[model samples]
Target: MRYRTQAVAYPYWVVALLLYGLQMVFGLLAIVKYLGPDPIRAVLPFDVSKAIHTNLLIVWVLTGFMGAAYWLVPEESRTELYSPRLAYWQLGLFTAAGVTAVVGYLFRWTAGNKLLEQPYPVKLAIVVVMLMFLYNVGMTIWRARRLTTTEGVLVAGLAGAAVLYLPALLEFDNYTVSIFYRWWTVHLWVEGVWEMIQGGLLAYLLIRLSGADREVMEKWLYVIVGLTFISGILGTAHHYFWIGVPAYWLPIGGIFSALEPLAFLAMAVYAYAATRRSGLAHPNRMAVHWTIGSVIYSAFGAGILGLAHTWPSVNRWTHGTMITAMHGHMAFFGAYVMIVLAVVTYAAPILFGRPHEEHETAIGLWAFWLQIAGMFGMTMAFATAGISQTYLERIIGLGYLETQQKIQVHFLMLLATGILFAAGVALYIYDFFFLVPRGHREPTPWPAAEPVEA
Candidate 1:
């Protein structure tokens, strides 16, 4: 089938890698704006840097999701995509739209929301591109030869792409409505759609890498997807707690948000048990490491820190502070970004017809550690800064600007941590693009021997 070939997946990987690199660059610029002198702020405005950071993040995640779709759709459907040409067109449109939107934001054309700041036209273009992609993927699945795996997960992710955009499209002139729509996009994408994608991709990877029965993995996939949707839809209420929504939302959001981590934990246990019992035919250490990191960080960041702010009492103090940002960065990067990277790593070797170089794998693993450590360090520093600033401003009645100056030192620490993250990204990009092995390698035959368990 045409989809069985690497050509369908190669372009997705290329775009993902490029966007990943750009995300890191923007990350560094954002850090510079936060830490560097006022002169640096003039060159790289905070709004521009923030827009770049958020937009780059969205681009990389989408790129990775596209690659995962290309890789998994063929295997699950047992058929080639209905039209690779349509996929190419989707890619072209999305790339053009993403680039144009980011440029527009940097040039000051924006909607003014923190994460949803792209210009109106750019937002419309994004919606159109998403629709095109949805149509192409939907058609491919419709014409598929089979649906042996968890089609629900795939459909859920696609549905999320559209559903999450609904609130943004709602015409409401009020800032409250704007905030509601913003969270609809933000919370649903991270806690809902991304989770579905992660579940589907993980199921596919587990089946391939662990040599586990597809049926068993598919069942686990159903459970994962079920939990994600059930929890995610209600969990969005957590963000509503401080947003001037109905007071009744607090309990609903907190309860569901608290249950969200259980899904990831279950996934971890399932992977470990499956691998241990089935005997991994291809125990890709890099992939395993990334997957494990994703679960651990998500559980801690989203589950634990998320619970910390679920209460209105706590959120009243923590909302809009660096503490919230700290939680968001770790949870999103760990849950979504790492899962995407794992899928890419798993599929890249198969598509390339060779294992990635051992050194490259090592580099990726090292980058994983660096990013986790750097993010942890930044989160701790920011949390401390946030609490201290809050107490100084609210409790001690310090001036807002004075409180900011007081926290400036902590931002310095955040900058240093960001540099470490940037270095790790550099290593990741270098290893993934320039150093990983490519093309076929001659198989090394072994003498006849007894059958091994693996």
Candidate 2:
């Protein structure tokens, strides 16, 4: 590690990896519950397992994000962390809250707000942790007397995410009203500010990994951000289609949400363009694979799949069906999960003091393909199940349980794919933790690379 303080990220990333592995466990469990007799139905219900699965994903992704910032900011700012001490405290608070939330779910203690299930105290703690993290991050940049657009965009996104969460802190009794504001928090984060974070990090990784001109890359970053804001903000209306909202939102949502894919397309183009310009001179080309993989997969998942069901007519049929799950699985995995893993792969050498030559290995390649194939199969499984369910239940007017019974075959397929995906996830953790690290040395001071001229 360059900075002694960079070691702080070790615990952060470690916790993230562990939680990520546990996430797959719950995910597989939920899928199994769908496929067969519920041996543990009385104790561990599907809803609880699903909730834990989803919540763990959020916590771990955010943890990975925070950890990435800790590792990247110092090198970017040309200074050590403002307060490693604060980073430690923030991770502790974040981890504790995650653990408590998981434990509480087992006991059925929740706010029951559908995905915003973290209890009030835990929510408050999350806010505090964000505050600490942002303060440390902000102060670090401030102290360095330097800030790149890449870093600026990243910090802004993180700040925006923290602000958006405020709405989740409040409660509403009316279902319509609650759902309205709930989108403000969830949809806005996923479709809005979080894209900026992804764009920023994507820019950072591509520039460093591809040997591309920083100016051209950041210029594309600006375009991506502009497109994101243009589309994603109004894309929020897509959720308003059947939510007792005004008729105007139907057209507005369809128009803007469809455009949201444009930004994702631009991101994929941005990564590919940068890499082609440089001819992949970077030794850790596998990291480049991940970086570029995130871009294209996100376009396919979030952009293409999202467009598939985003229109009002299409959503009317597919909204609450397996189609939603299909799109969600690909979108989240493609956009958020892959980007985080991209950074983890790219930064492994720097973070762990390994030689750059050891960046990507054969095992890493295996893990990557297994995951990509597994997730694709899972998406197809969901797509088939959803289509059958929609046709049986909605179109043919069959009862929900009866339709589900008819679709049990798809559930079995889902379990099979889930197991495959889970294995890939396991192999990833194993390769990242066990095989990636073999020795350690005194912390070496890594000097910032010379600036790439405009």
Candidate 3:
């Protein structure tokens, strides 16, 4: 809020939260299909609903990331944004493309390649949007002639994400080849570059919320980014195992996949050390809760649960089961979702002219805890369902359909927990849009600005 252009982030957040709410709706619909006979199966089929559910997650999270960057980069660079106009255009184009792709999927107009189901044109539009985003952000930094390591890592991650997505645009006739490259986008994203994005945001949040020394925090951030590349790049081989890849990938995947948790562990330690050194004295207690929660939850969900099934032997049994879903739900929530929420919570007071010292609200607190409890419950539900599935279907050789019937109870748990999670999301959306005041406060310099080396 120190800069006038920072206001551009508000609209982006508004769009992101709206999409988040819509995503929960489709997610509920998708789960309902699993628990009972489909009433609207013909009109809104499970495949379509599931695709929309997954795609919305990616879109809304990306939207949140972009908005966070718009808010953070200006402050980090000690200047206003390079072009707020360009940023708004980018958001409009990206949102339009996302909506078009989702609508197209409803009519069965898709590439039908799992998460990369967006058609060719939609993909191109996405690439262009990314270009615009990077250009605007890059120009902002260049003009300021100052860049912090925290924002540097973040911008690098966003650039890498755009580059990695190029592989998805290529057309491969071989099914195995297509699947191989698909992970380049999907796995490398959530597991690789996306982690860098999470780390950048984490460092920024810790520095702002915990009053952590910027010098020490950025130094350790270097280590976390190193671990991410060391493990994440090679960990792509893990996905290659089940595919028609060489036998060498099994060991390579297992070893590197096992090492992947190191990055998440480092993040957890990073947060802990910061909090330990600088006690939680920040007025934005809600953002602190979210920031700390993101690191701890990610360490468990992304690191521990992921390591559980990612090994070659363990994965051979639980590769495609609800176990992956289990790991995915919590990991995505803790790593990406929570971090974004932390930024939003931290910035809301500044953006809306509310007093920073008294920004924490009862509604916000409930939203945070509800999401934590709900995601934990949902993860357990998926874990139980996955374990049951692995035993009955994979081990006992039960037919898929029969195993599904036996696991209906677990699906019930999933639905019930999913509703809890959805309610939390609803509350968050309401808190952001309705509860937070709309009056604008005059711009003021950040009182706690720290010296930067990088």
Candidate 4:
């Protein structure tokens, strides 16, 4: 079968492949710096590599969301994208701006605000790109008249993305005030907006893969979004403790952030329940692997480990240490990045009009397991290092510099784990792009929908 390159799935594969490649390269660079000598850090500084790592993550995930939206929206609404040309333009502009911003960060041009450090102009460019994307998606939704569960979630995410930027763009002198709202952007977007996007995409995937009832999946979507907002909005307080905020914020943040994990837990249960209720033969085994893996890992890694640091007592020791990275890496990967990858896997064969090779699916599944194992190993090593550093710095009255030196071996272990992750990523890229079944001229028949249990 000759699969059309312009199919809805093509954009997703393009974005996923590009991001995976960048992620492997920069992810390796990050690991190498910590394991290598001081001179190596000079060549590839922490700040630069961190910027590349985080931004690549953000851009690629958003690109996946875009592709998902483009594919799912039209299918659900029974209409073509309102403007493919606009989408293409948005993609081109975003790619250019993202590259420019990454380059600027690599050379030390930044706003110096941790996650929000991209320079002013770059931030402005991001905002513009987002607005353009919003316009395109919004118009598509309007023209379609028929709204799906996923469309609602996607719109909500886009709205949250727009609103989250308000505080970062505001002029503020007091770092405390700036930091407070910074979490609104960082925390809210991840816990709130990204959660919505994940929920929507997961629902769409389940509908396709499991032949699950759209109504049931839609209800799950509402519950997920409701829990996310209820828990996630107040959850922003978790970051307030160390940022010179009121002492009262500690308890509020701790309690609400603790509740945030419940949403994820519910999502995992719901996905499993729905899939089991619908007795369908999933066409893509790798999609099932990724979907189930994402939900389970998010529940354990994001929910369980995240709860460990939500309290003031535990957080007091965990803050500014490798422990936080453990949570961030696992949670983000499990909750958001994995969902995006799953969506790509689910959509790719349909977009290409071909059945993916079983061997390739098996390879991708192995790569998934390896990546998860690597992340788990790295997080454990970091947690150990963080606790050791905390004891040395706080209990033993050792200097910060001395404590870092004391945990050098743990950092080396983290570097090794990162290498494992890179290897996993390499396998994934090969399995998806190079090794997967492709280049079909005939359209494959859509799989029969199985019965859905009441």
- What is the per-residue lDDT of model 1 for residues 45-127, given as tens digits with 9 covering 90 to 100? 87787788888888768877876776667656666777788778878877887888778876777778767776777778778
- What C-alpha root-mean-square deviation, in Å, does candidate 3 show against the real structure? 1.8
Residues forming the 10-long window of minimal summed lDDT in candidate 3: 445-454
RMSD of 1: 3.4
**Full-model lDDT, candidate 2:** 0.87
Lowest summed lDDT window (length 10), candidate 2: 445-454
Residue ranges of candidate 2 with Cα displaced over 4 Å: 444-454
lDDT of each: 0.73, 0.87, 0.91, 0.77
Off by over 4 Å in 1: 1-6, 279-283, 356-361, 437-454
Q: Quote model 3's TM-score.
A: 0.97
Tens-place lDDT digits, model 4, residues 208-296: 77878888889878988899899999888888988888889899999999998988998898888888898546757788878887888
lDDT of 2 by residue, 1-454 (tens): 5466767777888899899999998999998888768899999999999999999999998998888888778877878999998999899999999999999999999988877999999999999999999999999999999988888888888889999999999877888888999999899898888898899899998888877888888878999999998999999999999989899999999999999999999998888788788767777666877788888889999999999999998888887999999989999999998898888888777766666667677778877887888888889999999999889998899999998899898888888878777887888788788876765555445524412332
RMSD of each: 3.4, 1.8, 1.8, 2.7
Per-residue lDDT of candidate 3, residues 315-360 (tens digit): 9999899999999999999999999999999998878767676667
State the TM-score for model 1. 0.90
- Identify the runs in model 3 with alpha carbons over 4 angstroms from their true place: 438-454
Kindly report which residue pairs in candidate 2 clash with one another: none
Number of the top-ranking candidate, with lDDT as the measure: 3
Using all chains and alpha carbons, the TM-scores for the candidates as numbered come to: 0.90, 0.97, 0.97, 0.93
